[model samples]
Target: MTEPAAYLPVLQTGRWFAHLPPDFAQPLLAMAHLRQLAPGEVLFLRGDAPCGLYAVVRGAINISGTGGRADEARAAMLTRLEPPHWFGEISVFDNSARTHDAHAAEASTLLQIPHEPLQAWLTAHPQHWHALALLLTDKLRTAFVAIEELALLPAGQRLARRLVMMAEGYGQWTAEGQSRRVIGISQEQLSLMLAISRQTTNQILKDLEARALVRVHRGEVEILDLAALRATCY
Candidate 1:
């Protein structure tokens, strides 16, 4: 049998895998399957069987909900998952159809483990139950934050919060101390995630840029004042 390392880096770094009971490791590792996805490719659709969870190994994945009109502003949030981030987990736990569609935001590698084997392994390793519970708890917290953003925040505020969140979550230092360069993500994509019209999103971006809080480049967005940007998260 191929070892875990022989499959992909994602399974090796997954929080769920890392926290699994020692006894469950070998079995879980043995069943891991790896696949590479091209940019713009769909890993799985929303209604696919709630099989194994997926761990991102390289590149990014965007998770979007199903059943939204293209122009209705259903607010398809882009998760921007990095290595070790798991998706499709809720479906795996609940044994329901996948509630969201996951796609490669860039050329990516992923590890998938079948639900049947994972569940069987979990059954024998009751010690892992607490870890699973904690994982679910974190997911719930994030979901609540998303709900709050959608329900309470105005369009500009929602957009501001997302920019700050993305910058804090993914930006790298630019040696200017105050300036940090964010990864290449288009405004259209951000607009889709924010569930606002492209014109509205563009206007918000301009306003932030004018305030000297951010700088939008060809594809990258640079943070000039983290504190000021965060303050806009009202």
Candidate 2:
């Protein structure tokens, strides 16, 4: 496969790769190959031999289980990869088959690097491990927050928080410096993420819309007042 034009930003912007030793970054970049996925295409299936890491250059990919204890989307919403975000690293790190399925939620561009190449590169730069450790620590904290929300927060509050979180991750600044998102997610998707029924999701969203906290249009929800949303979560 032909190598990507540049994988540096993919790695540098990712929580996992940003701290790599400078020496390790170059070789890792060399191993990356660019690929495009159409909407609804499967990037990989669960239990497939792990190849390497995949980082999104543009668009969205949804990670979910194919077969495991729960073996369904309800079990997890593993990760949603947007531009400059990495996914599929868990499989690479463990040197095992993929534990989940990665599918394009929209037309997407990705950079995929082979695990063997990445491992060889990392071996040559032992100091890079420190950054990986820090990345994992932060991930653990994030995981804890998810667990806490599921255990203690109501479904409406959880939905509100999840929206705010996605906005933080993908919203762009407007001319007035107000953050706006172009996310095209649906009520059913939000229902799944919040572990609620579609009807409930619709009701909550309608209430938010009535309050001018958010706007719902065809296949999209725009957060109009983030402060109101933060308040809604409480």
Candidate 3:
């Protein structure tokens, strides 16, 4: 595959590739193949054989589980991954089938590194294992925090925290110094991620809007006052 000029630059921005030495990082970049997805396209499904690790180069991808249903649209979304994020590491490490479905939340670009090459690289450069471990640990810590929030936090607080996290995860400022913390997600998707009823989520969002903490639109939510939103997390 012809390497896109943007490939290396984009990979460098990701936490997954940030700590890699040039020797190891260069070879891994060479082995990656670019993959593109249209909106709502399925990248992989639960129970599907693991293909490789994926890094989101641009746009968003949704990770979800079926909740014992056949239709994917009905699946409960776990999270949305923006650029500079890597996933599918769990299945790659265990050599097991994919545990969740990954779909394009919008038109997306990805770099897929096949399992064999990744395994070989890891084996050859065992010292680099620490960086990979750090990546996995970060994911685990996020999961643990989610579990703690679900078990202990009230619904409104959980919603507040989720929005704040999303803004931090995916938001960016433009050169004009404008805080463009607009999240490209609908209320329904937020409800699924938080595991809350749509009605309850809508009410919470309406309350935030009333307080000038957020501005909700069709398929998007913009953070109006990030400091105030963070204050709600308590």
Candidate 4:
């Protein structure tokens, strides 16, 4: 048996793997390989064959699509996933090509679990199916929220909601013990995620800054007032 890598502890902390029984999760650790990715690196492109499951140990992954435009200007981001999140399961479950492209939003560390061994193990341990089902359900719920926001809310409200979600879901505590949400994304990326024009996104961000709700900097947005920011989600 292969000795677990030093980073196996980090993978064990992930929500998807943490709840599994020790007997089940231990084998997965042995099969997992750690991968380091540079900023803007493409992990896999859409339509690539399913290879395995991936969990982010550090930094972020941008899941996006490239549209039909010749210049690829019509590309849009679906979501940004940070540490303790797993992806690639959709393709693994169906044995289909990747549905979207995954890129490293920053320098990142990932754990890749190859499909063949995982599938074989899962076949023998059908009792673990519920965990996989729960994971898929959470992803679906997030998609539903994004769809509702895009269809019913104005651009400003949608942007606000996005910011709040980012802060709450991925933020960290400051040295002073304050809740500080730092979104490591550019304005253009934000606009793409929100499905709005960059100019509109900038205008809304400026408004939020003026109101002391957030501080927008190059390549990042810092949540200064999380409560007020959450209020805008309504």
Of models 2 and 4, which has the larger lDDT?
A: 4
The C-alpha lDDT values of all candidates are 0.71, 0.71, 0.83, 0.81
Cα lDDT tens digits, model 1, 1-234, are: 444466444454455556566666666557778778999898877788877867677788888774457676465655677666666668757888887788898898877778888888778876776766766776677668878889988998888777775655422212233322565577877887877888998898899999998888875678788888888886
Off by over 4 Å in 1: 1-30, 68-75, 170-180
lDDT of 3 by residue, 1-234 (tens): 546446777666554576677786777687788899999999999899879888888899999986653563465889999877788888767889999989999999998989888888888888876776766788888889999999999999999998887877632211222233898989999999998999999999999999999999999999999989999999
Count of backbone clashes, every candidate in sequence? 0, 0, 0, 0
Location of the lowest summed lDDT over 10 successive residues in candidate 2 = 170-179
TM-score per candidate, chains pooled:
0.79, 0.83, 0.90, 0.89
**Candidate 4 lowest-lDDT run of ten:** 171-180
Off by over 4 Å in 4: 1-5, 8-14, 69-73, 170-180
Evaluation by lDDT, superior candidate among 2 and 3:
3
Q: What tens digits encode model 4's per-residue C-alpha lDDT throughout 60-104? A: 999999787687558899889876678888976798999999999
- The stretch of ten residues in a row with the least summed lDDT in candidate 3 is 170-179
Ranked candidates (TM-score, high to low): 3, 4, 2, 1
lDDT assessment of candidate 3: 0.83
* Clash tally for model 3: 0
- Candidate 2 accuracy as TM-score: 0.83
> Candidate 1, TM-score vs. the true structure?
0.79
